[model samples]
Target chain A: MSSDRIAAAFARAASERRAALVAYLTAYDGGFEHSLSCLLAAIDAGADVIELGVPFSDPSADGPTICAAMVRAREHGATLTHVLSLLAQLRAQRDTPVVLFGYANPLLRRGATRFADDARAAGADGVLVVDLPPESAAILREPVRAAGLHWIGLVAPTTSAARCELVARGASGFLYAITRAGTTGTALAEADSDEDAALRRQLALVRAATRLPVVAGFGVRTPEHVARLAPHAEGVVVGSALVEAALAGPSVLGASVRALREATAR
Target chain B: MLRTPVDHRDDDAPGSFGRFGGRYVAETLMPVVLELEAGWNAAWADPDFRSDVARMLACWAGRPSALSPAPRLAQALGTAARVWLKREDLNHTGSHKINNCVGQVLLAQRLGKRRIIAETGAGQHGVATATVCAKLGLPCVVYMGAVDVARQQLNVLRMQMLGATVVPVEAGSATLKDAINEALRDWVAHPHDTHYVIGSVMGPHPYPTMVRELQRIIGAEVRHQLHAEVGKAPDALVACVGGGSNAMGLFAEFVADATVALFGVEAAGCGLHDRHAATMARGSEGVYHGMRSRVLQDDDGQLLEAHSISAGLDYPGVGPEHAWLHECGRARYLAVDDAAALAAALQLARSEGILPALESAHAFAALPEVLATLGFDRGRGEGRDVVVNLSGRGDKDMPTFAAQLLARPETP
Candidate 1:
């Protein structure tokens, strides 16, 4: 199954005693061609896994950077079908594991099982919906897992330990550790202060709740930020920062991911 | 660690009105929302909490707002139906919004939240939130869409006067939907200190149920007052559906009574074929702003921008309970255009001395349609009693009214 690719990628990083780099790029954000170039660039620059965000209109949990990008993407005629086709195009050029990330509206609109079938066919390894929590997303998860694709679980800083166990139960691929309780682009104050310690504590609880490879994310920017927090988790997801990099140009995005990947060395 | 306790159980159960309302927020907000749910449940169960909320509603919001007979309105309509008005317009904040805000801000205090945040399209909910926050001594921040801020500047000043920091959201049409998005983002950032007092019976689980129970006073009082006035329930109830808060409040108590016909009026803007906020008439089942409900969306499931002369009604989605009501055919949903609503507002002002908010005017505009369906006596004899929820006073809508006057030719 394509999902085994995720496990293999994490194992590859574990062999080197280094955290894997999970990079998020909004599919069709800068238009399809620009997004495809950026995706290839990120993979070439050491992005072990690509979390391709499908653009949504009402991204309530996302901050300004992502929200604006999503709007621009939507204006550029981005749709779920186009995103799946992007995944297919990416598959033609790369072997990097890709997880389709988005809100639940479009996914539910297409029927959960149908979405899973289409996603698998398009070479998507996993799925992560920001709004569909474990309590209400079983119908979605079952179909995703049934399609032989990994269903990514998200454990937030505000998630109780008991709830963490619930989210981890049927979760495949890896656990996405939301390092902060805020939206995507909120920056951390510093690298190794009390904030990191608090995150480390929460990461500990998340690790205890599940044996799935934990990837810490949200507000994760800068190589220093990644380096300071790398030893604690199996992988680190750089989202909005990478998006900002792509906005600067594809080369800047590549270099940003490259630097963040280097910092993952344990 | 910012971990909060969450009781994760079966989906579609918490605030479900037959598979309509459910908690669909992010994991970042899920636990905190669950905490709020638990707190609300505890508060509702406690007698002291209930009495405190009731007392505040009575003293602060001026509860039991007058329900009077619109005699002139009935005569002007030339219908046998005796028209009555539930004057939520006379409430302390000039709308029914204060009732929910009062209860929610108090809950914020009980939950030990230091700050309050709210989203508003028309300044009514924002002003009410600011008013309650000022009374309760909590710092308030209201997110208004930039377009709404421009249109409802008086409401902006009112919120500021009540000591709220008003933020203008500039994303996705910059209307109520965008404001709600910004507010939810704010809540995600400051989950520990701030409480979002959702203005409508929309959003996630506890909010829909909580807001409904808080505003249930509208219908509860109407049932009693109308019973005392005529020795029985009114034949019909009507209210505008802008996130369906006022309508839900008015329709909730009468739901069990099969005899009382319920009508929820939606804004049709210019016309049904043109720009409109007629979600029920031209909408599909989609998740929006954390609830699965009837939403106006494009083919890709992206929400379409809704249009209404009334800013409050210019929302893409209605409350999930309203969606359920429409689904089961328990109540009828109708759409009234901007011109009709404006005409109805003027008619009420001239005939009944009641100038209603543009949002409420939609309900007034739909009354003719509602009456027609109710089998009204064409002979103009005694007929059914129709009670409409005049949701707010039209003071804030004067600028729009004045613009209309300026645009019209002089009748010299």
Candidate 2:
């Protein structure tokens, strides 16, 4: 099962006294075959878990870099069905946990149960519906869990304590801890002591709420950032930076992923 | 005064209009939505809050705005039907937008929010929100699409003059939908101190319900005005539907009246078959910007960019209530092309000396056709009264009007 794989990956990283490197790449971003090759390259370059972004028309939460990737992927004729087919192809070669990261509209249009079934059949380990809050999660949770896929929840800097508890209770695989209070691709103020203190504080709050591995994401660009955030999180997710690299081709993306992975090593 | 009982049953369940409206936002925004919903409900139930809103509407917004009889317009159309205009164009901000803005600003104050944020398409809502925020001594920020800012420069200047910071959003078609996304992102970042004054009745939860409630005053006043002047309800109520606030407001009181037919006009940019903003005419059910409604989207659930001459009506989605109204057969929706809307605006101006906003002109454009369909003619002598919601004055649109009508007559 994908959830078990995610748990085991985190466990192995913990034993090695290092954080797990979670790499995010948009499916079919560089055309069907090239994007698949990019995913394989990321996994080979030491990405412990893979997050496959499903390109959306309006990615409100995304920053410019990811938005550019979406535009490119759309221009290349990437659709939800195409992404699933690519995932199926990738699953044939690797057992690395793969999660579909996207908005709710497409999944809702596809019908929640049907999407969960298709995703599981395509060898997806988990699903992170970015816009689906806990209040509306019932639309997908039962069907996803019943299909043996993890329903990951996101905790933001603005999330209240009570809501944090709810998210922790419902979260599967791991909780995604957003480091800042803004959209993805926004630069994190790693140089500012005050900003770093606040991020640490938020990370501590998220860690206290759940025993499951908490992965920190958003604005994580350099190895220095990964090193700085490794203590507070069990896993670090690098998205926009790697996506930018993938734009230059899989070779560049592989080197970038390897650098981030090496930075996670204690 | 025959006052109909306001139905609370429709909004009893939070964030739902049939199966349409729901809190389909990010988890980061869930708590804020719940908090805002609680605040709105408490304010709604409190008599003090109700009176406060009522007092502000009357004294501040110059409301109980006149319902003027448009005899000249009716005569020019060669129809025997008595036509009355609900003069929302006379409101403080020269538009019906002030009604929702004032109420929301008061609600934000009651909720103890010190800062206000809003998303605008044509800049009417931005100007309205900025006006209210300035009056209440609250700092305001308005997000407008870069494209909209370019087209509606006067409204942008108006908002700026009212002491609000206008941010130009440059993402995804650079229109109202993009502005909304930017505003939502801002709300997510500043959920504690800031209140998002959504311009329309199309967003998630409390907004559609709350904005509708505030706007219901339009219909309430029209009903009273018609009853006093003509001793009877109008045969029909007509308003243009963008995100549907004006139409919902005008239709709120009359929805229960089986005798009154409600008509919502959508902007058909060129025509229904061409680029248009007629969501109900050629749209499918999908979720976008927190509500499940009839939306203009591709087969893969990607939102398609809507086109319209009137910036206010250029949206891919309609309000949940309008969708429900169309589905249940309570109200009828029709599309008016840009050329027809422009012609109606010119006709009204030339005949009655009332230059209507392009958005309002859509309703006027559809009037003659709807009247013909209803079998009202000069020979019929029906004498059936019809009320058209003149939603805003066209002073701000003078540039577009001059550019389209005078500067270049032959070209669209």
Candidate 3:
């Protein structure tokens, strides 16, 4: 099943004594063909998991970089249906775990049960609905779990300990521990300061709350940043930086992913 | 004394108005929304909390705003209709926004929130929130669209003067919707210490119902005032709807009165087919700004930018309750173009010495259509009473009015 593939990816990374390198690319960032090339390139360059962003009109959680990529992807005719077809194409050639990252509106519009069945049919391993909190996750969780697709949960810096436990209980494939308090694409604070300490405390709390693999994302940009966060997290997700590289060209994105891969190795 | 219809109180479901309202926010903010729901429920049932808000409304913000007759405006419409203005403009903050602000600030205090954040379009809500924050000794932050900050400079200054920080949002559309996006982000980041004082009877749950309850005083007072003055309820009610707070306030009391007609005027920037903020006239059901209301969106469900000469009404969505009302035919919504609204503002100012906010002018501009719909004609009709909600004063909109209407004609 899809959850087994996600589990296998983490297990393999653990056996290799390195953190899993997860990369994100908005579907149709440049265009369908170019974006598909970028994703393939990232996988070839050593990304274990791919977070395929379904371009949304109002991405309130994202900063300028990701927001700009989504706008470009939309202009290039990317939609949820278009992204699912691209995922099916990618799945045919690779067994790498792929998570469909998007907001709730499209999924809600498509109806939860049908979206789960369609996503699974398209070879998506997981679904991360950005706006669906644990309080309302039941709306999507039942269908997703029934379809054997992992329903990813997110815990933010502002999330209280009690609430974190509630979120962790419903988390499936992994829990996304957001490193900072603000939206995605913001710069992380200095690695060893009060902010970093606070992040460490939050990560520790998350680890204490759930047995699921915890992946850290949002504001994770550089090789050194990955090296610093690898100890606390089982995986690291790189989004905006890779998107910036993808926007530049496929060659640049390949180099960027390779560099991140080498950083994860250390 | 006028009797409030018992059936109007029957639909008491939390966070929903006939499939139009629900919490569509991110998970990071869900716990906060749930907590707010519980707090609001407890507070609503508590007599002390209710009386405390009542006292604040009566003593601080000035309650029971006058219902004054507008003979000149009625005469100009060329109808035998007798028009009365529900004077919310005379409130402490120069608008009806204070009513909700006072109640929300009190609720925030009860919830142990020390800081407050809000989003504003015309700056009336921002000013009202800042005023209550100042009175309560709490720090306040207001997010406004960059475009709104430029147009509503007086309100920005007013908020600052009241010791609140104003953050200008430079996101999509740079208007009310964008400001709301920024405010929601802030709420997610600081849900523990801050309370988001939503300006209108819109957004997720609890908020739409809570704000409407606080504002219901407008319609409730109108019922008593009209009863004493005209010896009966007005035949029809008119109010402009941006997020539909003032209209909801005035409409709630008379909802079950089969004899009363409700008219909600929306801002049609240029026209309905052109750039306009008439969401009800040109919108589809979609989720945006934490509510599943009728939103101005493209075919792909992307929110479309709404435009209006009046900054207050430049929104892509209305309150969920308004959408329910429109769908069920409980109230009729109409669109008034920019030119007609401005003309009405000027006419009211000239004839009655009352300069109304551009938002309120939309309702005045619909006077003719409202009378025509009622089949009332000048000097040869049944005498019917009409009440139009003067939601705010024109002080803040004077600059926009001057630039648009009072400026000299350009020389070629």
Query: Best by DockQ, which number?
Result: 1
* Runs of candidate 2 exceeding 4 Å displacement: A189-198, B1-8, B381-383, B407-412
Q: By DockQ thresholds, what CAPRI class is model 2?
A: medium
lDDT of 1 by residue, A9-104 (tens): 999999998999999999998999999999999999999999999999899888888887898788789999999999999999998999999998
Query: Model 2 chain A, poorest ten-residue lDDT window?
Result: A183-192
Q: Report how far off residue B155 is in candidate 1 (Å).
A: 0.8
Q: Looking at candidate 3, what is the lDDT of residue A223?
A: 89
Best by lDDT: 1
TM-score, one value per model:
0.97, 0.94, 0.90
**Candidate 1's residue-wise lDDT over B1-412, tens digit each?**
1111122122337887777778889998998889999999999898999999899988878888999999788877777888999999999989999989988998989999999999999999999999999998999999999999999999999999999999999888999999999999999988888899999999998988899889999999998998888888888899999899999899888877777888999999989899999999999999889888999988777888999999999999999988888877778899999989988998899998988999999998987787778767363537578999999999999999888743677611
Spell out the clash pairs found in candidate 2.
none
Of 2 and 3, the candidate ahead on TM-score is 2
TM value for model 3: 0.90
Interface DockQ per candidate: 0.84, 0.68, 0.46
What DockQ class does candidate 3 belong to? acceptable
**Candidate 2 Cα RMSD after full superposition onto the native fold (Å):** 2.9
Q: State, as a TM-score between 0 and 1, how close model 2 is to the true structure.
A: 0.94
Model 3: how far residue B231 lies from native, Å: 2.8
All candidates' chain B TM-scores are 0.96, 0.96, 0.96
Estimate, for each residue in A138-209, the C-alpha lDDT of model 2 and write its tens digit. Answer: 888889988999998899887866788898887799999988777888777666589788888888888888
Interface-residue RMSD per candidate?
Answer: 0.8, 1.3, 2.1
